[model samples]
Target: MASRLAQLEGPIDTVYADIYNESGLRKETTLSKELGFKGKLIVHPAQIKIVNEVFTPSKSEVEQARKIIDAAHKAEKQGKGVVNLDGKMIDLPVIKQAEAILEYYNRLVINNQ
Candidate 1:
C-alpha cells in the first residue's frame, strides 16, 4: 500500500497505527525508522520516551553525518559536488540528510537545555 501510494504523483509518508503493547510499540518504532517514516503516533505517555529514543539519531550516526558533511564541503571546494567517503557516494541528498540529522540533534539539545 505504501509503495502504491508512492507511485502516485504526490507525497506519501508512513504512519504507524499500533498504539498499545510496550514491546510491540518498540518493535514498531524500529521498523518505522527502517521503513523511512519521519515519525510515529503513540497513544500512551509511556511510549513517548521509547519512541523518541528510537527515532532520534544515535551518537555514531550524528558523528558519521558530521564526517560526511565535512567531506562534502571539502569536495565542493575542489569543484566536485559528489564525494567518495569510505567507499560510499556522498551526494546532495546524502548531505541534506546529514544536515537534517545535525539539525535534529541540535533541536534536541536545545530542548533539553
Candidate 2:
C-alpha cells in the first residue's frame, strides 16, 4: 500500500483502515500521513467527522485558490499566457487546476447533504 501511494500525487489525504484493529488503524494513519495523506480515511460512520476534519482545506486554502483563479482570468483577458502571483508564474493550466479544486470542493459540500 505504501509503495502504491508513493507513486501517486502530492497531498493525498485519505486512507481506509479496519475499525476493529487499533494497531492497524494507527499503522495505516501513520503511513498515510508519512506518504502524504493529509487527513482522510475510510472508516465507520462514527469516524466521518474525524476524517472530514482532517481532510477539509482551511479558510486560507480557499482564499488562495480564489485569488489564483482571479489572477489567472485577469491574465487571460490581457492576452498573457502566464502571470506572476505571489512570485510564481501561473498560466491558464494552473488557473484551471485551481478552479477544479473549487469545483471539487463544492461537490463535496453539496453531496455531504
Best by lDDT: 1
List the global CA lDDT of all models. Answer: 0.79, 0.67
lDDT of 2 at 88: 94
How many pairs in model 1 have backbone atoms within 3 A of each other, for residues 3 or more apart or on separate chains, i.e. clashes?
0
Model 1 deviation from the true structure expressed as Cα RMSD, one decimal place: 4.3
Q: In model 1, which residue pairs have backbone atoms overlapping below 3 Å? A: none
User: Model 1, stretches more than 4 Å misplaced?
Assistant: 1-20
Give lDDT for model 1: 0.79
Residues 1-113 of candidate 2: C-alpha lDDT, one tens digit per residue: 56446754446555465656655555665666556455564658755655554445556767788999999879888998899999998877788767866876676676677
- TM-score of candidate 1 versus the correct structure, residues matched by position: 0.77
